[model samples]
Target: MNTTPDSIRHVALSTVRLPLAVPISDAKVFTGRQKPMTEVIFLFAEITTEQGHEGLGFSYSKRAGGPAQYAHAREVAEGLIGHDPSDIAKIYTQLLWAGASVGRSGVATQALAAIDVALHDLKAKRAGLPLAKLLGSHRDSVRTYNTSGGFLNASIEEVKDNATRSLEAGIGGIKIKVGLPDTAEDLRRVAAVREHIGPDVPLMVDANQQWDRTTALRMGRALEEFDLTWIEEPLDAYDVEGHARLTRSLDTPIATGEMLASVAEHERLIDERACDIIQPDCPRVGGITQFTRLLTLADRAGLDLAPHFAMEIHLHLAATYPREPWVEHFDWLDPLFNETLETRDGRMILPERPGLGVTFSDQARAWTTDAVEFGIR
Candidate 1:
């Protein structure tokens, strides 16, 4: 670590709301559990050290709670003003304690995530190395797949068209939303997508925790013929025992954990042998610090890794996984950054640029709904 006092001199936080082209409906929306998600709310943290080094990181929420994350971040970010930006784990603990009243997981950890990630980005930038290189990369590229194109809102034709375009663009796999109320409809959609993409391409489906055990099993069996890569979140996120049972019963690999907010929650899934693949979202699991901890545990259990979102950050983190990993490709976030990630032959190539390999675009600033800052810069 750089011993120079290059203390974090400023922390600028902003809330950017990115609108989807259309209302995104998943199983959650169709099940009446939540309304269609029209936007993704982000808490962006831009941290600067006294030495002039800077880093940018962001966390996001879907449907609601954007304000709460921003408010919580604003409250705790003050503590980072004089701290060495390289002491990521220590600073993460301090922020967690700063907001101890709200407990350690969910929104509290999520809010801290942006700060945690920003610190990592700063440390990597200061070293003049890409974040993946800073973290010890296992590979420069990770298998990539597209999820933004495969939502329940789109019809079979739309889904097929999206898959065709995505493949042409170099995405390696296709994943479509499943678990609509009608099982037959879900099957028909999956069948159509499989037929369109052909069996040679990787295909996966997400249930978004909308299915009961019986339904998940039945669908799991029915979808088996398609030779899916994995079935994601077929049961509730916390249903470790349920997931374990389903995992044991199905030949298809089970993937979950994006909804988990902390390392301990994921520990349950890893300990109990719940799933074959683990999909931890960096921001949602409290940024790279906690996400790395989960990766160690998942690796020991011999589980496959496929980080959920935020390809800008996950691309670096996933590249470091001991085992080859998959990074989800969502073009929705493409406009937020001035640099774009490349996908070819179904893999996301880690950017050679230092830190998270991205700089905020003017559009990101234009979408800012709120902003706050702490300390001098």
Candidate 2:
């Protein structure tokens, strides 16, 4: 096993689209209204090495606009064929800039994200090390906070019940959705959840960009009694000035950047002090390459880095950067992968296996209806 640079031979990219239909729990609705059973789609990326090792990565997206994502994955994969899979940063930048004509952010970044994760997995497999080691190991565990275990659409009893279950499960903190019909209702929900979790456990609220500046400020003021850990995306993602104003006006730290697509946007947020925490998602922020850069920017700005989602990948990044407070927890999409990461007592144990230490399950791949293999030549 001569694991030298020359041992890396070839790379290929392929996609499998998994279709799912799941019920929205009482605690997971938007605007206090529960929608009917909705279809969820997940995209999987497979990267192969000449040495016969392979790795898988995935992204979760709503079903309505999935074809666009599939197309974007194919377009980005075109640039990955025949390249050295070990060069994660180089390949990431190629796909990132390739779609510059269409815009560097959004779908382009997501496409790059999937490929980047897979390539890292491939590299890890080659080196016989875990992704955390490949990324620069620090702590073997990362803290996690519950997301959407408490819903705005649920009754007060239901909300409390779910919050209780989440806390009992060992989650250090819980995040609830707010900003539905009115600010008053939002305040009530936050207060109820806070009481359910008690004073010791941390609580956070995500508005999902549902409120304007005035309403956000008003709600932020009202939520003060509940002792929120952070107020997430209370205003439009692009409204940097409004975020800055909201940050200054509120006692709670304003948190955002999940919707951001590039390091430059994150830098702008940091430069303006628009948020106390920067949440860059691997799939949304141009993959690990950009995410590492964003962490650097956060370090420079004296800000905290709490990645948006993709806990498995975020765990590696969090371990790499000990300053990150927490990684979001959502288990809905875990089954779609071949190998899944585990969380115990509110802490994620970094995968010690090489690469991502996870693979797509056969059942998960069976759910993929449209399978497209790129770079067939």
Candidate 3:
């Protein structure tokens, strides 16, 4: 086989094993849930060009079942070997169709998403441009919201305290978790938080798929007096009709789709007017390439794009999209990464460095144990 510096050469994939305890506090959970500790699995892909430039990307598996996620990543990696790292879209399309028989959504798409991100990272590095600039330079800074310090297990007082602290930290917006033992009690907690934060600061609430449509509508109406920014995932994630009903009945906007796996699902939600704001998690969606497409879809539909998590990637997407209001910030897993995403005055500055502009620290690597590498050509 012949290879040139600018030509497709070899691709290597590896798994960096890192374990995270239950209750990812600073986002949701206050008292910290009991045992059955959770481990975060990161799928890292290194794409090498004939020129010797290597690009890196990562995927996370945080569910109770790990075998399936591991297998999915490995299978996708096999298809990515020998593909040009610069052809990010082509590779993504190939992996997307490779799993077509099983459907191009869910774990399969998520697996592909990780690989796509790594390829984009590599492509950006080769081009010597930040991912945001490569995508489209719309803004130099991206606004952010605090997803930490919400603590579902914390007492009302403690929740208030955390909210106050986040405000003091200069976050323009804050998200809190609801849907507890009783709807009435949940409303009370939300009301107390609203009172503490005052009316000027934007407030969003997430139910984490805990309530049904009726409950969501009732709660939405009840919380109208408090002026919530949005009610997220109030029903099952796949329940587009339920979300539409809730959106129609409530004064507050309905926000869902973080669990969504494809643009098709998002199109359905947007076409139906089910959600006012679209929240796509880069890892859960199909990475940056697809995310840029999704942003376009939302823009045409006149909907807002506020990414779910992965602030590092979201910051870039938000900076490129221009209409994205905020990127959710939760620092639980950041320690495992090499670089920390900077946030100040409720905004994040898009890194000027090439590619994703972030690296995984040795300290973060210490969290890894067993490893698996793939994509050798």
Quick one: best TM-score, which candidate? 1
Clashing residue pairs in candidate 1 are 172-346
Better of 1 and 3 by TM-score: 1
lDDT of 1 by residue, 1-377 (tens): 65667888999999999988999999998999999889999999999988899999999998678899999999989999889887898999999998999999989999999988889999899899999999999998999999999999998899999999999999999999998999999999999999999989999999999999999999999999999999999999988999999999999999999998889999999999999999999999899999998989999999999999899999999999999889999999988999999999888888999999999999999999999988997
lDDT of 1: 0.93
RMSD of 2: 2.9
Candidate 2 TM-score, C-alpha based:
0.90
lDDT of 3 by residue, 191-279 (tens): 88888888988889988777776777788888888888888888888898999888788889888889888888888988888888889
Report, for every candidate in turn, its global Cα lDDT versus the true structure: 0.93, 0.74, 0.74
* Residue 274 C-alpha lDDT in model 2: 98
TM-score, structure 1 vs. true? 0.98
- Model 2 steric clash pairs: 27-151, 129-354, 337-360, 337-361, 338-359, 338-360, 338-361, 339-359
lDDT, model 3, position 361: 68
TM-score of each: 0.98, 0.90, 0.89
